[model samples]
Target: MLALDNIETFRGPAKILHGISMKIEEGEVVAIVGRNGAGKITTMESIIGLLRVKSGQISFRGENITRMSAHSIARRGIGFSPGDCGLFSSLSVQENLEIGRWHADPKRIDKMADGDTLEKRVYSVFPEIEGFKRRNSLKLSGGQRKMVAISRAMYLCPSLLLIDEAFEGLAPVVISRFRDALKKIKEMGITLLMAESNFSNASLVADRVYVLDRGEVLYEGKPKDAMNDPRVKKILQG
Candidate 1:
């Protein structure tokens, strides 16, 4: 459903992604895996148009999105969850979720296009959110905040979800809950593209993995294969 061809990205004067290319098929969970400073996030920003590419092309749903703005790309049904979670500390959980609803128009929603409302989809993946829906976001625990971030993204009813470091810094139990939630999202037929620095975490949810080093693709294959590859092991160790 998405393809990047030799896409190069720059951060200030420095190039961050050097001719990076990859593909994600519909309904598949794909991962961009690498250590810190490997440009995993840069690749994502390049795809979503947060950072304009210096060269090459990005195509989503068969249409070129290289020069599209982030708002425009999101309108086409792409949801992004930043690594920091990006929740509104001053707002009630319900109010935070309402912002995502702005992405959906009365004439056209995403998978929620089937008649289900945006709020229902968020609560479906994160039923726990309902319990604290009226609470100020600053009062919640780290896990709860993460759920709010995911739910807010779901409020857009997106077909593709780009989650940055979804498993990072969470308790193992919390990670397990997110894994289950992601599974449900997959079952709902939403494509997932997760950026992860930890190999083990990426393997937990990805069907296919792309190892990025420095600013380019180091390897691309199934998660199992990537785990066993000696080269990948060395790259991760260093």
Candidate 2:
């Protein structure tokens, strides 16, 4: 559902992603794993058009979206959930989700008319959210806030979801909840490309893994195989 071909990204003169290439098939849960400075987030930003591409191409569903703006790409069926969980602190749970549904194109909204299903599924995955639906976002626990952020993104029902660091700094139980939610999302036929620093948590959820080191894709394979690689071990344990 998503493909990146030799894509390069730079912040001013400092190159962050060095000829990165990867593909995510429909309904697949793909994880990009890396240490602190591996450019994993930069790669994701490039794909979602948050960063300018210095070279190479990005394609989604057979269309070249290399030059598309972030808003345009999102309208084209890509949902992004950054590490910060981009939520409006003042908005209630349902109100926050409504913002995600406010895309420019009316046709795109019609195409993604699964908001009811999305709400039901998200609330099912996070039953706690249902109780807190009327609460302010800033009043939520860290994990609960994260759920709100993810649910808002999923409210649009994008074909491909780019998730950055969903499990960072959370308790194990919360991480488990998030992992289960991700699996449910995959079962619903939406593709996922996630950037995670936690190897064990990622291994539990990812079907395939790509290991990046120093802004380069050093390894890519099945999650089990990638987890066993010496390089991957070094990077994760170092």
Candidate 3:
């Protein structure tokens, strides 16, 4: 569903991603694992057009979108849920969801007219969010805020999703809830590329894993294989 070929990005003269290449198939969950400043987030930003590409190409659904703006990329069926969650503190849960609704394609809306199905599905995966539907988003806990952020992204019904640090700063129970929700998202045919620091939690949902270090893709393979690699172990430990 998405492919990045020899992508390179730089901050002024300093290079970040060095010819990074990867592909994510439809309905597959791919994890990008790395330590701080390893360029995992930079790679994602390049894919979603937050950062301009210095070289290489990015393609989505057979179309080259190397220079597309973030909004254009998003309109082309990619939804991004960043680590910060990007919630409007003043908006109620229903109001926040309404923003996502505006971004949905007309064809998708026609196919799923009820719209309630999306809300129900989100609430099903995040039962805690249902109770907070009428509450202000700013009033919720960290995990609950993350749920709202993810739900808003899902409401767009995008073909592909780029998630950053979904497991960060939350309790284990909330992480488990996110894992289940991600599985459900895969079942619904949304391809995912998640950048996470927590390898164990990422492995639970990722079909494949890519290991990056010092702005390079050091390893790429099955999660189990990457997990067992001595280099991976060394990097994680260091």
Candidate 4:
């Protein structure tokens, strides 16, 4: 339900996304695969309005949001979890989530679900978060931190979730848990757009894959075909 049309964005004076375009249908999981500096995060940021698009349009559910502010975009049912996890180290996990819940617009919740609130949805996906609600975010392990970040973003009750570097630096076991959670999210009718450096891992969850190189789309096809491409595999392996 999200579409990017010939979007060209820049970071400072340097252009980073060269007419990037893609579409994400509702209830589908799409992955953008690339090495560092391949415009993966840039594309996500542009869509979420963290970075403005210099040229082209971004539409969510047929509404143009290219010039919308980041807060407005979030209020319009777009959840974003940046690569850094963006947690408040001094706050308790619950406190962090409370901020997100407070800021989120409940109307953004998808209509297809059983009308569960954002808090309920997040807790359902991550029971571990409930147990750690009182703990300081700074004290959690890496995987726990990632879980908390994802949970916090879910407080937005978004129809679409955009995650950047979601699979980096996690052990296989931890990654598996996140995978299950992501699957659960899809079942809830929320679309996912995950940016990953690991093509192999991205392939496991993605229905479609887009391989990017130096700000351009080099390949767009099924995950299997993208993985089988020597160029994509070599860049991912590096």
TM-score of 3: 0.93
Please, what is the whole-model Cα lDDT of each candidate in the order they appear?
0.88, 0.84, 0.86, 0.88
Give the poorly placed runs of model 4, Cα more than 4 Å off: 109-115
Q: Is candidate 1 or candidate 2 better by TM-score?
A: 1
The residue-by-residue lDDT of candidate 4 on 14-125, one tens digit each, is 9999999998898999999998899999999999999989999999999999999999999888988888898999899999888877877756555535766777788788
- Looking at candidate 1, the ten consecutive residues that score lowest on lDDT are 104-113
Q: Per-residue lDDT for 35-55 in model 2, tens only?
A: 878998999889889899999
Model 2, CA-based lDDT:
0.84
The TM-score between candidate 1 and the true structure equals 0.95
- Which scores better on lDDT, 2 or 4? 4
lDDT of 3 by residue, 1-238 (tens): 8999999999788899989999888889999999988899999999889999999999999999999998888777788888888889889988998787788775765665465477776777677877888899889888888888888887876788889999999888778878989998887777989999888878989999999998888889898888578999999767
When summed lDDT is taken over every stretch of 10 residues in candidate 3, the lowest stretch is 108-117
Q: Which ten residues in a row have the lowest lDDT in candidate 2?
A: 104-113
In lDDT terms, how accurate is model 4?
A: 0.88
> What ranking emerges by TM-score with the best candidate at the front?
1, 4, 3, 2
Please write out the lDDT profile of model 1 over residues 1-238, one tens digit for every residue. Answer: 9999999999999988889999999999999999898999998888778999999999999999999999888878888888988888889999998888877554546424556777666777888998999999999988888888888877777889999999888999888889999988898888999999888888888999999998989899998888577878898766
